[model samples]
Target: MKNTLLIIFVLFIAAQIIQTPRDNPLSDPQKEIQAPKEVHAVLKKACYDCHSNQVQYPWYANVAPVSWMISRHVDTARQWVNFSVWEDYTQEEKEKKLKEIFRAAYAAMPLSSYMAMHEKANITMEERKLIRDWTGVRK
Candidate 1:
């Protein structure tokens, strides 16, 4: 039992040494998504952390294992739809992304896993509706 415990402790310490770079790239203010102030507020509070280049990392983002998860999730999210680079996408890409946002507005967004630690990122039903309305995309 002592040996097992020691091994676990060692592994935990070793995990901390693994670097997880999370530098947010600088984005032009003009390139960010344009929305009504209200809609933008909701998106800023709920979606920006993972979907934009302006991530406000949490305390746990500096820890191991979990930090890796957060970094990877943000990286993946940026690849899917980066609001900070909204104007960089082609017209068709923007339309497709808007459609995706419309669909994700229901429940898939802000991911439950993320909302678990970030209560503020939880989208209220009204906010969800507002986002859907802003997207102007039909179901």
Candidate 2:
């Protein structure tokens, strides 16, 4: 009975994994508010997973029910602030949003848990400094 239950659980997880949605919003640099590539890379690696449309799901996101939670979070967060569609926001709004993003990253909010699972999401002090510096330069 235990073995049967395990198999059922595994199958359910696999099915949920197959249901993960793909929502990659193509980023057009031409339309984006200017920032150094280092800043962009920092945000892409650390923030984009949740804040943008390009979410790189982890293995656990494929598990049953886990995928549902992750999908919901990703969808909701993207709607709140989409870096891929950054240019769509007004100039003042973009600056305000960038300031908010900088504050969150500096405070280590976005990837605190994310870094535990995905080490690459962990920001080095220097990387954080770059993001902060670039955020200041944005008008």
Candidate 3:
């Protein structure tokens, strides 16, 4: 039992040394997607953390296992729709991303796990409507 506990402690400490890539690539503000203040606010609050180059890392994000998971999630989310580089996308890509944004906002955006920590990121009905309206996605 003592040896097992010691190993576990050592493993935890070692894991902390593993570096996780949490890059926020440079993005041009002028080229960013334009939206109303309300719409942008909602997106910034709910989606930016994972889907943009403006991720705000909370303290826990620096922790080993958690950092790894957060890095992977952010990477995947950015691959799908990175708002920071919105102007770089083609028209078809923009349309697809808009549809996806509307769908995610109405269905499962600001994922429950994220909301657990960032209560403000929880999208209300009004915010959902704003996102839908901005995306021009009808119910």
Candidate 4:
């Protein structure tokens, strides 16, 4: 048991040396997505952390395995829809992103795991409706 514990501890320490990128690049406000204040508020609370270039990394995000996981998730989220560069997207891309946003919100995103850590990021029904209305998604 002692040997196994030592090996596990060594592995964890080694993992810590693996760097995870947690950059939040500067975004031009003038080129950002335009939306109503309420809509923006909801998105900021529930979506921006992963989907934008303005992620507010929590303390846990500085730890090893968690940091790696967060970095991967943020990368994936930004790839799917980066609101920080919304104005740069083509009209078709904008439409696709809008549809994705509505669908994700309807499915209770911020993701349940994310909401578990960030209670404020939990999407309410009204907030979801607001997003849907803004995106012009009927369902």
Q: Rank candidates, TM-score, best first.
A: 4, 1, 3, 2
Q: Which regions of candidate 3 fall more than 4 Å away from where they truly are?
A: none
TM-score of each: 0.96, 0.74, 0.95, 0.97
Evaluate all candidate structures by whole-model CA lDDT and list the values in order: 0.90, 0.75, 0.91, 0.91
Clashing pairs in 2: none
lDDT winner, 1 or 2: 1
Query: Candidate 2 or 3, higher lDDT?
Result: 3
Better of 2 and 4 by TM-score: 4
What value does the lDDT take at residue 89 in candidate 3?
95
What CA RMSD would you report for each candidate? Answer: 1.0, 3.8, 1.0, 0.9
Q: 2 or 4: which has the higher lDDT? A: 4
Give the candidates in order of lDDT, highest first.
4, 3, 1, 2
Clashing pairs in 3: none
lDDT of 4 by residue, 1-139 (tens): 9999999999999999998999998989876788999999998988899999999999999889999989999999999988899998999999998999999999858877888899999888999999999999896
Please give the distance, in angstroms, between residue 31's alpha carbon in candidate 2 and its true position after superposition. Answer: 3.5
Cα lDDT over the full model 1: 0.90
Model 4 TM-score, all chains together = 0.97
Q: Name the best candidate (by TM-score).
A: 4
